[model samples]
Target chain A: MNLVLRAACVYMALLFVFRVAGKRSLVTVTTFDFLLLLIISECTQQALLGQDYSVTGAIILVGTLVSLELGLSWLKCRSTRFERWLDGTPLVIIEDGRILRERLAWLSVDEEDILEAAHVQHGLLRLDQIRYAIVERNGAIAIIPWREGG
Target chain B: MVEIKRAGDLETSEDLAFERTSRRVRRVARSLLYVFVLLAALGLFGDGPLSHARAGHESGFFVRYERFARVDGTTRFQIHPHPGSSAAPRRLFVSTSLFERGHVEQFVPEPASVEIAADRSIITFPRVESGGFVVLVMRPLRPGALRFSLGEEGGPTLDLALFVYP
Candidate 1:
């Protein structure tokens, strides 16, 4: 029971923290972020186990975490807005050779990021050649080029 | 400065769709954040500040310790350990800040094995087998919710609200 309680509390805390930190902080997976993630895992260990290292306690903790995650998944499926809130919605960074500066700034992203994605993904040399650049919900950039006829 | 075109002239059908969706997401995210903050506040209120923020609630046999104390004031409380099949003496750990610099009454039983942490607030009982009521009277030095756990720190804690009187 203590284990379950600990697991639930830890899960809630971690979830809120991750949410506030934003997906960009995680998706890139920089070396510093990796270290930070490791340290967070280490810190949560004591909070979850507490003074009890019994096998029963370990089982309860693991079970509770898994159950909570599964429950969130179920909640997400049932609620579209919840899914969007948790994962964020995709945004148009560029439309018809014009950059959405406000949108990019809101995400802490710059023109260089979109250009890099454009160059790498679409092999487009010039920014004007691209009709649209989008910041996906998963923090990846997607570039769309203007069609030959249009 | 990065060149940014006005949304009114530059936005296409696709851009409008993305903007609408993003606005919905922003609203949802704000609401979610507010909800989470409220939940966190409620949890902090329900659990003691020094309870180590465990993910679970206390289950199993527990002892009811003093739930309130005052700074520089006398408090008398009884700990009644719920009986179980095992009659073994249960160890009690009082990580309570109330014990810091406070004086335990003379009548309180001497714990078989005890340790007062360096900060002087945390008290540990290595072995306490008494299944009956153990009454404790103390004159607390500090005020605030004092955390007393059953086994050890991060264990099941009973927070005693303390209000200091000037």
Candidate 2:
């Protein structure tokens, strides 16, 4: 009972914190961010396990966390509003050879980020060559290039 | 705002209105996160400058303890016994709740003898000058508010409470 309760509480707390931190924060991870993630996991492990070091305790905690994740996914599938709120929707940051400066600023994405995404995804050189750029729900930028004359 | 259309073959739901509101909410939440971290650093949630506290008159009978402590983490408290006649033994009394919740790990200036009772435990120390003190180290067994007391026998007993964080 203690194991399950601990797991559920930790899972909910982490989920809320990570969601509030914004998707862009983890999409591009620096070395420091990776170190921070490791430290966070270590702290979480101590809270979840407490003094129990048995195999059964570990199994129970894992099961509880997995079950909670599955339950949330099920709930997300049932409601589009919930899905949008939890996972967010794709945002169009660039449209018709123009960059949406306001949206870029809100997302902390600079012109350099868009250019890098454009260079890697499509060999496009200039912003004029790109027709649209969408920031996906998973925080990856997707670029669409203008095709030859119709 | 630019009008967004679902023109591509890729399956994606483009909701600029929701995205805008979500970003605003995210900004607000980020501000809250900053406050939370600041408070934690100041020891509002656990051990820090704010957690260290003292109670009672230090000149006579007093105690120094942490306002906040971690479960299973070692914490130390000092008790200054009131000065009495030179030949009289200095005795200190501790509430049994301290024994139950606070797993007493060590004691400095070991007591000459300890008498366990149903409500409280009486600790006797050899006769010493007035300014001397004793230190008790404890590892809390659980979280939540722990109420305890320490005082010289038949003298002023000080009641104290500390919160243990998990």
Question: Each model's DockQ?
Answer: 0.02, 0.53
TM-score of chain B of each: 0.43, 0.82
Please list the Cα RMSD from the true structure of every candidate, rounded to 1 decimal place: 14.1, 3.2
The collision pairs in model 2 are none
For model 1, residues B1-166, the per-residue Cα lDDT tens digits are 1123454344322334445666565557768878866754553323233322321233443444334444444655555443443345445555535455466773255555565665333333334453554556777654454544333344454544444321
Worst 10 contiguous positions by lDDT, candidate 1 chain B: B49-58
Worst 10-residue lDDT window for candidate 1 chain A reads A16-25
> What is the C-alpha lDDT profile of model 2 across B56-155, one tens digit per residue?
9866788988888888788888887776675788888899999888789888888799999888998887876667778989998888999998887789
Candidate closest to the true structure, highest lDDT: 2
Q: Residue A49 CA error for candidate 2 (Å)?
A: 1.3
